[model samples]
Target: MIVLGVNLKKIFNNHFQKYIFLYFLVIVFLMIGISTGAITIRTVDDTAREQIINYLGSFSSIISKDADLNTIKVFRYSITNNIQTIIAIWLLGITVIGVPIVLIIIALRGFIIGFTVAFFIKEFKIKGLTLSLLYLLPQNVFLIFGFIVTSVISILFSISILKNRINVIRRPSFLNRFVNYTITMFIISIIIIIGSLVESFTTPIFLKVINNYLTVFMK
Candidate 1:
């Protein structure tokens, strides 16, 4: 019994180490994507620049205004988007081809964030940086964290399934694990919803305050 316990402990430790390594590897990929995005922003052509600026401008206009937003609507949208991504990851993990797809999703997330930040910094200079930090970073931080966690869990489960196919371990019951994964995703989605509320309600107020400060300071 003691020996069996020791073996299980060793297996858990090994898996934990692998998870850590995979997490950091994903982080590196994300950072690389971010750097690439920043470089892309710097090297785009005149027409491309115009389009990018216009695209970012639409988002900027939202927070720059002093009007009230439909908070419930924003919350619903945020929750829906988050839950969709989570479900996609969960479903993909059941397939052998999902590993690359999951990685691509992670990279795409990083790229969008990186590009937005770079665009802001390039267009508004220091003020753009301030705006990105204040208006963009808060909600994205939560979303990104949730993405990483869900992706890691998906990849781990996928790998485990592969191992079971090769007879490395007996096939374990999946229902309980799936339920736990679903519950975890629900909790993470809630965190994301809170972030959406902040973005919709608190972020505009923050941007307004910062804009006023910058205006007075410049004067």
Candidate 2:
């Protein structure tokens, strides 16, 4: 356990700079997309808020107005399948094309968060802030850290491998590049799983708070 802790601390210390930069990039992209979306929405209608609420209603309807347990089971399976499909694609690139693939995955993840947050904020006004804080803020904290670490480790492995700094791949060594990537991905996967569980449990509570508080305030 002590050895594991020491290794983890070393890994985190090594990647700290990259992690900070990645977070800043994510925040900047989020702000830009949100500002653009807000400007676009302003040009459409003065009753932009009503339109947003309508859209939210529609979206929520799709989620809640479902069938029984069997339908929910299928829906859950579909979601799992989609996530698995994405992971498989990324893995394919990791093994074939190498480290650039991980960087691409990081960029794509950031873009999705930025776009989604921007969309919600434009549509729901202040409620978007509440909902996002309740939903995304916690999960994103975990995700960004996990992704940045994974990305850094991938890059490090690739660079060392390419430069022949790490001949352990062809020879017997304590830390092979492929083994490092696998371990890094495994750790990141756990963070993602925990984040998902937190989101699943916490979001509904936050949503209820918004429903109750905002419903009274808007009246």
Candidate 3:
């Protein structure tokens, strides 16, 4: 019994370490994409810059006016979009090709975030930085956490599937494991949804406050 306990402890430790390593690996990939995105934003041609700014301005205008009404629309849109991505990651885990796809999705998410922050900072300087931190970071921090956790689990499951195919790991209650995975994913989905709600409902209020501050400061 003591030997069995020791063996289990070792296995748990190994798995924990692997999960940590994978988490950081994913973060590194995300950072690479983020840096690239920031650089791209900084170097884009004037026409492209104008287009991007105009697009962002339109979104801001919508949010600035009738924030309460737009909050519902934003919540619906954000949650739907997030759910689709989560579903894709879950579905893709069943296939061998999903590993790379998951990585790409994570990196793309990071790139979008980096580009947005860069754009704001470039255009508005300190005010942009403040907005990015207040308006963007609050919800995104949770969303990123969800994405990283989901991606790690999805990749691990995919690897498990591959190992099962090759008989590298003994098959024991695969169905049970899968059911647990599904439940876990559902819980993580809820977390992401909460983040969306924060972004949709809470962020606009922050934006309004910031806008008011800027107005007074400029005056």
Candidate 4:
């Protein structure tokens, strides 16, 4: 972990003075996306709210009833979804045009998390907050940290390419930098995987226990 952090720091060591503020900007966008997502839940119609409630009930039942099955299914989904997101960010980070898209992706991730958390609170009130803190926040906190690092790296690489357009690809020095970027992304992917593992195994058990105790949770 220390080595990975050191490597990531080195990748931006030279450019830090120039591009350090970009991380703050990316975080602002992410926060905007999250706040927007939470607000969106309030705008949901009564019909949509009913649907969400129904879904929650079904989800609670599934996790509570079929422990092994839920674990397998959730693990598969978490792995597939998390890996695809990672790959998309990694690939998109390769080109300058992808910079805006990377920010959008981060925003979308924040939106999803915000919406989920808001929905839980809207439905279950205090109990939902407990669930969110315990089940929703832990894995997502690490994943968000990984994503923030990845986002900053994406912006930096794109800006780096733009600043050094004179035969950037042919320059072996650029290649070394690219290697560092790739390695950093690979490490972030591992962190993402670990987050997914927590979600897959821990989430199911957490939700099952919550559901059992909070019998009046949804319906």
Model 2 segments beyond 4 Å from truth?
Answer: 1-7, 14-58, 67-96, 165-175, 203-219
Model 2, span 1-219: residue lDDT tens: 999999988977766755676545544544554455445554656576666556545534444464342334543553464346336533643443565455555655666666556656664678777677777788667656655555555555555555554464565442565676766677666775655555555555554554554455456
Q: Give Cα-based local distance difference scores for all models.
A: 0.73, 0.57, 0.81, 0.80
Clashing residue pairs in candidate 2 are: none
Residue 106, model 1, lDDT: 84
Error of 3 at 122 (Å): 0.6
Q: Least lDDT summed over 10 consecutive residues: which range in candidate 1?
A: 210-219
Higher-ranked by TM-score: 2 or 3: 3
* Clash numbers, per candidate: 0, 0, 0, 0
Candidate 3 Cα misplacement greater than 4 A, ranges: 1-18, 60-68, 206-219
Q: Per-residue alpha-carbon lDDT of model 1 for 81-193, expressed as tens digits?
A: 77788889888877768977888888877888888789768767897798788778888777777787678778877787787778845767677766776676666566666
lDDT of 2: 0.57
CA displacement after TM-score superposition, residue 150 of candidate 2 (Å): 1.3
* Superior candidate under lDDT, 2 versus 4: 4
For candidate 4, the TM-score is 0.82
Return the TM-score for each candidate structure.
Answer: 0.76, 0.60, 0.82, 0.82
lDDT of 3 by residue, 1-219 (tens): 999999988975786687998888888888977897898897899899867655545545565676465578779988999999999999887787898899999999989989889977887789889888888998988899898888888888888888887894687577887897788788878879988988897666765655565445345
Q: For model 4, what is the alpha-carbon lDDT of residue 208?
A: 68
